[model samples]
Target: MTDPIRIDVWSDIACPWCYIGKRNLENGLAVAGQDDDAPQVEVVYHSFELSPDTPVDFDGSSADFLAQHKGISIEQAHAMNDRVSQIARDQAGLHYRFDIQQHTNTVKAHELTHFAKEHGKQLEMTERIMSAYFLEGRHVGRIDDLVALAEEVGLDGAAARAALESDAYLPAVRADQEQARGYGINGVPFFVVDGKYGISGAQPAEAFTQVARQVWAEHQV
Candidate 1:
């Protein structure tokens, strides 16, 4: 029997494409019908902060951050975000309000994800964080906000708060960053399929489907 496919995804909650990439991956899995027969693939979400140096309370919108980071005009940044927002909407059924976006460092958010993983609710936590950032406009970089989201997802709110306050999962977040660097990854929404194939960006569902099938066949050796 073939081993279960292992998928490691490196993403950040603040990244719109990460959510789109996640949906595309799910669509691919559904199209492949691997859920019917295979010992379902194992998916692990890794931390990848797009704006590691962002302040806890960013003073400006996402446009401001992008403009500063890329050394471009606000108009150009807005145009770029608008295009990505449109693509994300079509791919993930997400509505990104760039104007309301609170650009903050996601390091603590990633640590909370690690805490969720310990409680076997990593995926749920991931989804909640993504939704909060993109759809609900929650302040993801704050400890209190993260604890509330954790409770909403059925995790221990106090524990989550403690983890954030004590920086408990900081090591796990660092490990993810080290792994990404080891893999030569320098971008968000990077996927490693079956621990062998690498897929980058918010690829088309068909592309993901093809990779899933290919990886499955190879594992069947």
Candidate 2:
């Protein structure tokens, strides 16, 4: 059997573009898979916190946070978020409710994804957490909330709770961050295909499809 093409993605759950990129990558893979002899692919998500110092219960809205973080006016932040939201809806069919988003430190959420990885539910957990945060305006920083999300993905809620409370996956989260640093990755939603091809930002589906085809063809030769 041919080896699957491995894709390592560094993204944060709080990143709007990361979610859009996720959908685009999926769509791109689906397009590539239309061929009967298309190579199989494997995706591994890594942690990259966009706002590591953000409080679990932030005192301000996402717009306020963005304004301060980017040195922009609150109105500008709102406008920017609106533009991105419109793009997400039109391009990826993702409904992002930035107005109701609960911005928080995503370390715990990242750790929860690592725990889910141990049980082979990492992808499902990541999707559920991102959807909860971006679409449902749910709080993902708290342990109880994360455990609930784990259960939603068919993981053992109690074990998840224990892991979170004890910080069992914290090391893994840190390791992922350290690896990101090693690669000099300063942005979220970065993709490293086969540990070499680097694609940054929320690129279109065609970009991913092209990379997949190129990498697979190179391997076959």
Candidate 3:
């Protein structure tokens, strides 16, 4: 059997397209039969903060944040979010209620993802966190909130809290950032396939399937 294809993805919970890209990747895996009998493809989610400096309690709306950060108007932000939300619904069956989204920094949440990886629930926890942030209106920037979310994913709440309180797994988060920088990654939803091929943004599932097939074929030789 060939070695598993390694897929490293850099993303942020606050990034709508990251979530979309995740679904699209999953769709690609399903279509390619990579999820079934092919050489294994291990997925690793890395941290990339879209709003590292955002306050725990953001006073403004999502539109405001986008306007301030991207220099776009509120109307444009809403339109953009609407388009992405519709895409997500079609692609991932995820219903993103943009009005309910809580805009907060996700540094600590990313740290918790590292912790969850140790427990073999990294992907589950990542999905949960993203859903909490984008759909359920959970506060993702605080340690306490993260602990609660961790518990929902079958992790020990107290231990998760302690880990967050002590800055545990922070180095791992930084390491992810450093690795992205080394790879010249400047955007979220960046996918590196088999340590060589790079696919950026929320590309279609066919694109991912093509890349996966190419990488798998190369490994077979």
Candidate 4:
């Protein structure tokens, strides 16, 4: 068997574009090759905080959080969020409920993600976390909440809860951030393909396909 292509994804759970980028990458894979002929790829998610300073329980709505955090008017924040939400719905097929989203720190959530990775459920946990935050209006900052979500994805709830409480994967999250800094990545949904090619932002599916096919051709040579 040939080696699987490796893709390192640096993104935040709160970033809507990250999810959009994930969808685009999937579409790109479908365009790149068939189920049998497609290059084997492993997507490893890393931690990035869009708002590291966000409180565990923000006192207001997502709009209020954005306005206060970015020093913009609530009206402006709502408009921006609306535009993003529309894009998610139309282009990405993701339902984003920013109005009800819990604006909180994602450090612990990243920790849970690392835990899920250790248990071989990282992808499922990552998707579930993003969906819970963006679509289901779940508060991902709390340990109890995260524990429940972990269990929903076939992980041990109590173990996940204990890990979070202990900050078990905090170092891994920090290390991932340090690596991002080393790579000079300051944004979410950044993709590093095969440790050589870098794809930034929520690029179109064609972009991913081109990169995937090009990398595969080179890798096969």
How does residue 123 of candidate 3 score in lDDT? 95
Q: Largest lDDT belongs to which candidate?
A: 2
TM match of model 1 to true structure: 0.95
Using Cα atoms with residue i matched to residue i, what is each candidate's TM-score against the true structure?
0.95, 0.98, 0.95, 0.96
Show the colliding residue pairs in model 2: none
Q: What lDDT tens digits, residue by residue, belong to model 2 across residues 4-107?
A: 89999999999999999999999898888887668689999999999899999998899999999899999999999999999899878999998889999999
- Give the alpha carbon lDDT tens digit for every residue of 1-221 in model 4: 77888999999988889999988888888887674567778889999998888889988999998899889999999998999898888877888988688888889999999999999999999999999999999999999999999999999998999999999899999999999999999998999998888899999888888888778877787
- List the global CA lDDT of all models: 0.88, 0.93, 0.88, 0.91
Expressed as tens digits, the lDDT of each residue in 1-221 for candidate 1 is 56778899999988888999988888877788755554357789999988788898989988999999999999999999999899988876778888887888899999999999999999999999988888777899999888999999999998899999999999999999999999999998999986667888989888877777777777777
What are the runs in model 3 whose C-alpha is more than 4 Å off? 34-37
Error of 4 at 98 (Å): 1.3
lDDT of 3 at 113: 95
Question: Of the candidates shown, which would achieve the greatest TM-score relative to the real structure?
Answer: 2
In terms of lDDT, model 1 sits at: 0.88
Least accurate 10 contiguous residues by lDDT in model 4: 31-40
- For model 1, give the 10-residue run with minimal summed lDDT: 33-42
